[model samples]
Target: MNILITNDDGVYADGIFELANKVKAIANVYVVAPDSEKSAIGHAITIHNPLMVKKVNFRNTDIDAYAVSGTPADCVKLGIEAILEDIHIDLVLSGINNGPNLGTDVIYSGTVSGAMEGLVQNKPSIAISYDGKNISSKEYEKGAEYVVQFIDKIKDNLTMLDDTMININIPDIRDTKINGFKVTQLGIRRYENTFEKRIDPRGNIYYWLGGKTVELEQDENSDVTAIKNGFIAITPLKYDLTHYDRIGRIMKEIQPLDI
Candidate 1:
């Protein structure tokens, strides 16, 4: 299998490197990622500015790697459209991210957004994250190892023809023991005091983002709840944002404009 690996945590981060290394043992791997951390950037693409790509060594790893001067999604774009244009990309794997990307967190997660880019191009993708206070290289390795095994299973059996994305979040390795993987749905995870007002030395007021968690009710089958229960959360995400059930009611309320 030909795989493209990327991350929002930058090209030199342990998580991306570990993931690439682990996947390399199973298939042809290519790495293209942002040069600096681009976390919480969502599914943004770099268009106005010129994107720069540089071939670099991934700490003596043999896989072909590049650092892009753009967002995490841009890396996948360049990989498919330019860098490996001729290669048949079987999958795009986007991250063993430093933190959990569960629930509504996926909406703002560049890690998940990176993989979303692949789905846009009709390629299957996976976004993996570690739910730890401080993610170590060991944690990254564990995520990579588990994902590698999962892919192996899919490769041997699943004959999927649809473009889809899988979001996976592994629980913290310390304190809590992993129960196993569970398919889940996205849940609510919003932050209270999302902004903090502050004054600069020059007395200019500025508001800094203070995205601290504000706990809300979540279903037992939610990805957020699964990670909290020591299980690896796997959710199949869709790109369509339409609420089909509300469409008819909305149309009936205002379709034949009277103005």
Candidate 2:
């Protein structure tokens, strides 16, 4: 299989490196990622500014890699349209991210957004993240190993889909301690936003953004709860944001006559 990989943690992050090496054993891997970290960038693309691309040898891995000077979405877009147009890319994979993209975190995750872009283009895609434990660094060998195992499990079905995407979150723990995988739903994972006021040497006051993770009490099927209980969370996602269940019932309550 031909797999295209990208991540928000830059082309040199250990998570992406580990993932590339591990997945290469089963597929032809091509990585196009930001030259530097672009965390929490969401689904942004570099339309106004020109994107710079450079070929680089992935350390300890003989996979094809490109460092892009843009967002994670930009890397995937450029990879498909400009770089690998001649090659048949069967799957678009993102992450093995440095942090967990759980629940509402996906709303601000470039890792998920990278895979989302591929899904938007009707390609089979999956976004994988390792629970970061609030720490910025991660040892992704075990997580990467699990991801390869996941690929082996689902590799046959990748070519059979056109409009679906999957999100995988691995716990930040020892491999042997991991319980198993759970198909989960989005949980009420949120953040308590804060800003700290401070004065610099120039006597100017400024506020820096800060927040703490907050997970609301949810059912056991929630992704947050699954990870908390030591299971890898797998969520099937779609690009449609419509509240379809409410539309018909809501329309019945009001009459519209060019009002």
Candidate 3:
């Protein structure tokens, strides 16, 4: 099997390197990622700017790698469409992310967007993240190992429908023993945002965005709840955002205007 790996954390990040190292033992691995961190960039493709890709000598690994001057989504799209066009990719894996991408916060996550892009191209994809706010290289290695184990176990039996991808969140392994895996849904996650106004050296006013996550009551079968309980959260996500059930009701409520 051939697997293509990409991440918003960039091609040089320890998380991606460790992940590629482990996965290469199981299958052919190709690494294509952003040159710099593109966190929270979502599923944006670079259209205005010309995307420049450079061949990278990815650390101690022999895996074929490239660093793209674009978003995470662009890396996958370019990898499939241009870079690795001749290679038949069996799966796409995004991340062993430095931080958690849980709940609705995934809406802004470039990590998730990388996998989503692969799914858009009709490939089975997965996004894996470690629930650690401040993590070390060792922690990233542990996360990568766990993800590889999980992938190895499910590679043969995994079946996904069209327009769907798997989002996996691993609990922090520093102090917690992983109980198991829980297949769950995306939970509500909100943040209390703060914009701090500051004066620059030249007396220019600037504002920096910062926020803390707001705690909320979550369902038992939610990704957030599972991660809190020391379980790996595995949520199957769909790219389609249309509310199918509401379409009929909305159409019925509004009368058609005749011109």
Candidate 4:
């Protein structure tokens, strides 16, 4: 199997490197990711500025790796279209991310976006994340190991529909035993946003975006709920944003309107 791995955390992050090392044992791994952190960048692409790429030695792994001066989506796009164009990528895996990408936050996740980009190119893709917000860095290897095992288990039976992507979130398992995998749906994850206004040394005003997660009632089968109960959450996602059920109702209501 040939796997292309990318992450929102920069090329130097331990999560990506550890994942690459573990996955290389089972597949031909290739790493293409941002040169610097682009967390929560969503599906943004670098169009206005020229994208710069450089080959990098990725730790103890011998896999081909590149650092891109762009977002996670750009890294995957460039890797497929330009960097590794001659290669047939069997799977595109994103993350083993530095933090959790749970519930509604996936909409703003660059890690998830990286995998979604692979789906856009007609490749099987998955995004895996660890609950690292409160965990130690030493635990990343364990998370990587779990991800590799999951991939190995599904590698033979993996069949991705054209419009779908797989998203996985691993809870912080340092203190708790894993409750195994749960196929789940996205849950509500609203944030109480805070924008602190501040002045620069030169007296210019600026706002720094910051927020804490707002606790809300979640469904029993939600990704958030699974994580809270110590399970690995797997959610299948599609890029289609159309409200199909509403379309017919809206058309019926508007059909009598003259141009």
Candidate 5:
């Protein structure tokens, strides 16, 4: 299969590189990613400035790679729109991200957005993340195995045509004693203090994002709860933001009486 791999953690990130190498053995893998880490950039695209892509080599790997001057979502857009237009892209895999993209974190995650870009083009995409930021290359090997296994099953099944792309967050636990996989919904993962302001040289101001203290108050069958309970969380997210169920009620309450 022609699989295109990209990440928000840049081209040379340990998780991305490790994932690329592992998947190369199973399928045709092509890597196109940001020149540097663009974490939490959301689904931003470069419009005013021209985006550039350059071929680069990793430390010891001979993978076909490109470093793009854009966000993670921009990388996928460029890959589909301009880079590999003639090539038929079968699957788009985003990350082996350094941190878990669980719950509402997907909103600000470049990792999930990269894959979302692929889905926008009617292509199958997968967004994978490691639960911990300190995940090692060895731990990514396990994620790599799981990715291949997951795709293999889907390729064999081919029953669900309406299935949306997935947001998969795998735990960094190396014990392999996982609570298995669960198709979950998005959970609430909000930070108490999202940013911390500080002064730089010349007394210039700057801000740093604080860590998230995940909450599961109103949600039990959610990605956060699944991960917290030792399960590999798979939340099938879509690009559609419409509230179809509440449309009639909202229209009845807000519509003008002119008609």
Candidate 6:
């Protein structure tokens, strides 16, 4: 299997490095990630600016890697559109992200967006993430190991029709045993957006975007709830934002007259 890997945490991030090291044994791995952290960058592409790509070495890991000066989505786009057009990429795995992509967190996750890009092009993909920032590099080794074990079971059976891209979040507790996996839905993450006003040396007013206070509602099958309860959360997400269930009801309220 030919697997294309990328992440939002840049080329040097331990999470991506651990992921690559583990998956290399399962397939031909290619790493094309951002040159620097591009967190919360959504699904953006570098259409107006020139994008750059440079080869990078992951000290101990003998794998093909590249650093891209672009958003996470752009890396995957460029990987397929330009970099590996000749190579038959069977799967695109994004992240083992530094932080969790739970709930509607997927909307702002560059990690999930990277995988979404591959799924958009009809390729099988998966996005992996760690729930807590306190998780050590050694902990990621365990998470990636589990990912390899999980992939080995599903890789050959995974068709484009069966599973496209799913967001997977692992808990951060080093000794906490995983209860198992849950097929979850996206949870609602309540946000308190605050912009802190500041003055630069040039005496210009600037605002720094602040972190959100995350609160998950009690939904048993939600990704947030699953992660909070010590199970690995696996959510099958789609790029289509259409609210199909509401379309019929909305159409009935808007009557069209013959003109």
The per-prediction CA RMSD against the true structure, in angstroms, equals 1.4, 2.2, 1.5, 1.6, 2.2, 1.9
TM-score of model number 1: 0.96
Candidate 6 on 1-259: residue-level lDDT in tens?
Answer: 9999999999899899889988998899999999999999999989999999998887667788989999988998889888888998888999889888888778999999999998987788899999876767788898998788778767768784243588899987664578888889988886787889999999999999886865645688888888878888888988778899999988887767346
Q: Cα deviation of 232 in candidate 1 (Å)?
A: 0.9
> What digit string (tens of lDDT, one per residue) describes model 3 on residues 143-203?
8878888887778865653568999999999878899889999998998999999999999
Q: How many residue pairs clash in each candidate?
A: 0, 0, 0, 0, 0, 0
Residue-wise lDDT of candidate 4 within 1-259, one digit each (tens)? 9999999989998888888888888999999999999998999999999999999988856789999999999999999999999999999999888878888899999999999999999888999999856555567778888888788778877774456898999988776689898989999999899999999999999999999999999999999999999899999998888999999899899888687
Model 4 steric clash total: 0
When summed lDDT is taken over every stretch of 10 residues in candidate 4, the lowest stretch is 132-141
Name the runs in model 3 displaced over 4 angstroms.
201-204, 256-259
Reference-based TM-score, model 4: 0.95
lDDT of 6: 0.86
Give the number of the best model, judged by lDDT: 3
Alpha carbon RMSD to native, model 1: 1.4
TM-scores for all predictions: 0.96, 0.92, 0.95, 0.95, 0.91, 0.93
Residue 160 of model 3: what lDDT? 52
Please give the distance, in angstroms, between residue 66's alpha carbon in candidate 1 and its true position after superposition. 0.2
Comparing 1 and 6 on lDDT, the stronger one = 1
By lDDT, the better pick of 3 and 5 is 3
Predicted candidate 1 versus true structure: per-residue lDDT over 1-259, tens digit per residue: 8999999999999999999999999899999999999999999998899999999988997899999999988999999999999999988999989988988889899999999998888888889998887788888898898899779767754336255689999888886798888989998898786777999999999998876888899999999999999888989998888899998898899969667
For TM-score, candidate 2 versus 6, the one ahead is 6
- The better-scoring model by lDDT among 2 and 3 is 3
Q: Model 1: residues >4 Å from true position, as ranges?
A: 157-161
lDDT tens digits by residue: candidate 5, 1-259: 7888999999989989888888888788889899999998999999988998998986667877999999988899898888888888888899999989988789999999999998887788889999876788889988888887778768654334234788998976864467788889999887776788999989999999777574548477899888878888888888888999999998899879576
Candidate 5, backbone clash total = 0
Tens-digit per-residue lDDT, 1-259, candidate 2: 8999999999998888888888888889999999999999999998899999999989956788999999989998999999888988888989978878998889899999999999987788889998865533345877888888887888887764566688999887843368999999888776798999999999999999999987578878988888888898989888889999999988887867356
